[model samples]
Target: MANNQGRSVRQPTLLEVIIVLGLFLAIAFSFVSVVDLPIQLALFIALFLIVILGIRLGYTYNDLQEAIKSGISNGLEAVLILVAVGALIGSWIAGGIVPTIISFGLEIIHPSIFLLATLIICSLTSLATGTSWGTAGTAGIAMVAIGEGLGIPLPMVVGAVMSGAYFGDKLSPLSDSTVLTASMAKVNIIDHIKSMLYVSVPAFLISGAAFTIVGFTATGHVDMAGVESTINSLNSTFNIGWIMLIPAVVVIVLLAMRKPPVPTIAFGALLGVVWAGLFQGMDWIAALNTTYDGFVIETGEAFMDELLNQGGITSMLGSIVVILLGLGFGGLLNHIGALQVIVDSFKRFITNTGRLSISTVATGIMANIFGCAMYVSLILTPKIMEKNYDEMKVDRRVLSRNTEVGGTLTSGMVPWSDNGIFMVALFGVPTLQYLPYMWLSFAAIILVIIYGYTNKFIWYVDDEEEGQGHELDIASDQKA
Candidate 1:
């Protein structure tokens, strides 16, 4: 599909794009299921297909290489953040912060309302931290531990944890996706936030309701025997005191104060080291080593060992690699114009506000699938649909809102995606198992469609007004 200029590419037909994508997905699924290899291997397989497509399209290997580099570069900061969070978790656990939270958590947080409470707690934490990963790795883990102790299904607990985490990630001004959506759609950040509440609030309320109903109906009684054993194990393994919580509290407070994630999390990790050495009677070298190797407890109790034996930079390496691979794959697709081809193929049908909004949702989900992360979806969907919104006299904020619904909200649903891989690795819950439980994720999509079709909260430009644009005129105008 190249004309000249060493790969002036022609747009791919919809069928051509779908065939390649379908083949890539089949390879990925086969690798993950039948082969049972690491997910990164699946990404590599998909990347290879993309590379082949680029070459066939007359793109040079160097061009494809550059694209891959661009993709990996986009996620470098997140990779570092993942490593730092890993260190933070390792230190937090070794220093007794997580154990302390669980101990105190088990006492007051009744098993009956734990899921409801989890949704609220995680939302607040992620909103403050502006990171679902950090929230999931930290407070989310604590909630999972608490849920396990209460005998709740891990999927239900992880579902609640993720639903809240995404709630914050979508609405929190601190979130990159929120900021990116605002910038991309040319909407005021505050306006974007306010408008998003129209969608997010309803989704959150529904999700919260679902969690509450599940919580009250479930037979998730506190396992008094397991709880006592866990408490004893925590008390024996680490100093059980309120002082251990200072590190976690400091991290959350610093994040809430708008400190950069890298430095804030780095400080949090260091505080864990100091706290562990000073309070837990660990040698300085041993405490520092935990940052690399993570917290490891050889408690005689298998359950305690399983619960406590996680965290550290080493533990996050797999996730980091997966992210890089996904980014590289996405980058290549972008460089080869594969994503644009797909979007262009789909964009033509978006003739009105409702169709545009719904199509944007579909684009967001598709971009995440093909582009491999929320970042790409956030970038690609708006780039493709911005004109359609303007043509429909729709405010860009609605575009931004729908983008968040499709992109950030669905991040954890894709198995190899940034949020998905990290959550799976951290919680050991497979993506599909928890996907159904992310009620807000799907709710956001449904809500967007409802809002779109109903024309509620969607602002349209009026032509008869002084803005020099008529509604019917704008809607009727077609691109040459």
Candidate 2:
């Protein structure tokens, strides 16, 4: 009921303010570095108060309550996905599957062909493991050592390595970013995956071609001997075989069967434990410890030592912390209406459905950069997307999948971003070196445009089924 003042009677209350602000601050403060903790925390806390003050001053109690609910409600499922992603990381590492992948990776690809191979290899491993960081930090490191020892230009190699890692990260259905993107957009993850190929495949193909051309033409020197030794060392350390492909295959089949991700990865992880103990001679007790704690090994070869060693749930802690900080900041921006204001500003430009699709892709790209994390990008995406969808009467999954296609996949090129950091560290190459290899991300962006404006693979809905995401709707989206 409207009050005498003509405002909605269900005004947002003050208590909701306390819950949101407290949650945001708690998450932000938990991740602040020890050295900068005091300053960052104080600023974050002050910002929270400022938001509440701004709302109380400008909005009705109802508006405030709704806005708070709008922001928090949007992210409710995201929190669960984040924790599941954490567990997935731990289980993958514990299973010895990650180490096994790295071992095989070093054996198959050559240092001369390394740049192109790095992109392909990392892409596959990240695809298999559904983890860009794990692929980058492990196989990526080995590639970097091979690059450094070979005298390949650091930036070129780093750029290529990062590009490959993130491509895998973006495309892998097992990835947290992929899963969360689907959830937030309210599309089935399979639909999200299918939609992603609209951009991702072309981008990866072009990137591979570019890197291959560069590899053939480059004058860079590399320590082939050191690379060989490292590869040999890794081969001896783990049971590297086609048999290791089982965990990855299981994930693919389960996802294809329309199973949820948490169980799929959990099952994949269990497969890993069995294989590690059975084939690699890794004791069951040690394998379990590695899953819960962390895992690393020594080969005694100078460069081959840390190069071939790493994984565990512990490896993802740093990434998780970084992710939380970005999410907390984004949540505050959303709470204060900055996010909505930004989204509204886009509406002024969209005169038609075609234009809105173009704009949606642009917004997705920008969100990935500004938010600096997939969780934030996914959360912030629908702020503008829903308005456009409602205005144009396009399917919500169209906007949702486009956001995933554009934002989550393109994070590889941002030099200061998490994917970039992992790639740089992994290859021991600076980001600038392999920028040419990053053409895959660019290609993906272009593909999103084609999908949207061209309506080529764009999924639409029947009048009755619109907005309510169902399995049939998802199947139709893909089929359509």
Candidate 3:
């Protein structure tokens, strides 16, 4: 390609791509893991390096700037959702919704079954909200506190939380990631979800079983006194009641009705403000203040104080910064053709269905690692592999399913990625600490690779006329 100045522009060579990406990984890992600094700075430095690479590839500064803008635009929905979730969490706490849920949870959930229950509850919430972030910030937080009281390890609790959350995120039709993946692969959203069920359901069952086994065999003694005291603090601090749950209900109902997530969550936050005034005895000013700065209370109980002292728009600022930096870095890499070069390097190894499947999965994983965002991976991976799948006569849904299995599932494990930063910020658990416990993600990836080799659930274009056709017919019937 030639630039506007009539200068020839070329893709980065494999060696140059390797060097730039290797340097980026070294810098990011060194700064984030060893130096214990924030990931934003590392990403910024990486972005700067990519800009130099882009210029070296003969792209003008203007062309590179457009790529950065485009990358950031791709993730604007997530940024909006994060902002809304922050306000929603704060308002819900101020309105006593989360406290009520936690109070009820503590009373009913047994220590022997807490881990399994956490997974189930988070799955249901994420399925309903179509948002792992919202589920994590809300029910996941409550579960963490409950786990603390139950004497279960925090990492175990967060692991269960994330597994369940991502389960819904991967399969839910309402999820943005799900929709994006399906669109990019030219598959129907329903078809995309149905194809993923083969991998996701087994993974979910395995995760549930694992949590159950761990929950039952655990020797840690539950702190009944702590649980009771925490419950009491919740009751005294706010007007906890079933009615306070209305805000959450509204959000779920709106989402179920297929309302847009941003406005739905914002509306829920508004209702929370009203509830806080009516039931929590807070004036409108104080309740509204909580929406921006989060709810503040003096419960005199350290655990209660710590759990409740969160939320607010300001709280999401750090995450937003990380997301922006990550997206910018991804944009620069894409513009410089570094990502394309990396993907092309994997093309020669795709000699069979199994090789193709694993190669696609590996590409998705690498995209998330190098792109610093799941959106970047989801967008780029399918586009890169779409032609390969078509030429191989494979069903497009397989492409979408494998893309999500590789991209969405492992995104939270990359400590510098947007999902990873959000998980860490919300749960205060290091990514590495809870990573091993993400049973569903690990299971899904393994299952896809296994299925690819075994030819199980690997749909082909010819099979679609008889197999996927019937499935689509059934789906249409069910919709009717």
Candidate that would win on lDDT: 3
List, residue by residue over 345-381, the lDDT tens digit for candidate 2.
6677887656777777677665654444455666677
**Can you give the TM-score per candidate against the true fold?**
0.93, 0.62, 0.93
lDDT of 1 by residue, 1-480 (tens): 553345666555567677889987887787766888788887888888887787777777887888899999998887888889889888888888988998888877877789999999999999988878778877898999888777789999999999999899777888877898878877768878988888889999999999888888784455778777777777888888888888888888888787878888889899989988888888889899888899887877788888888889999899998899999998987777777777777666776667888788888888888888889999988888887887676867788899988888888888888888888878888888988999988788888898888877776655355442223333323320
* Candidate 3 lDDT, 200-227, residue by residue in tens: 9999999999999999877257778878
Q: Candidate 1 vs candidate 3: which has greater lDDT?
A: 3
Could you report the Cα RMSD, in angstroms, for every candidate shown? 3.7, 8.2, 3.4
| C-alpha lDDT (0 to 100) for residue 224 of candidate 3 | 82
lDDT for predicted candidate 3 compared with the true structure: 0.84
Alpha-carbon RMSD, candidate 1: 3.7
Q: Order the candidates by lDDT, highest first — what do you get?
A: 3, 1, 2
Q: Which model is ahead, 1 or 2, in terms of lDDT? A: 1
Worst 10 residues of 2 by lDDT: 31-40
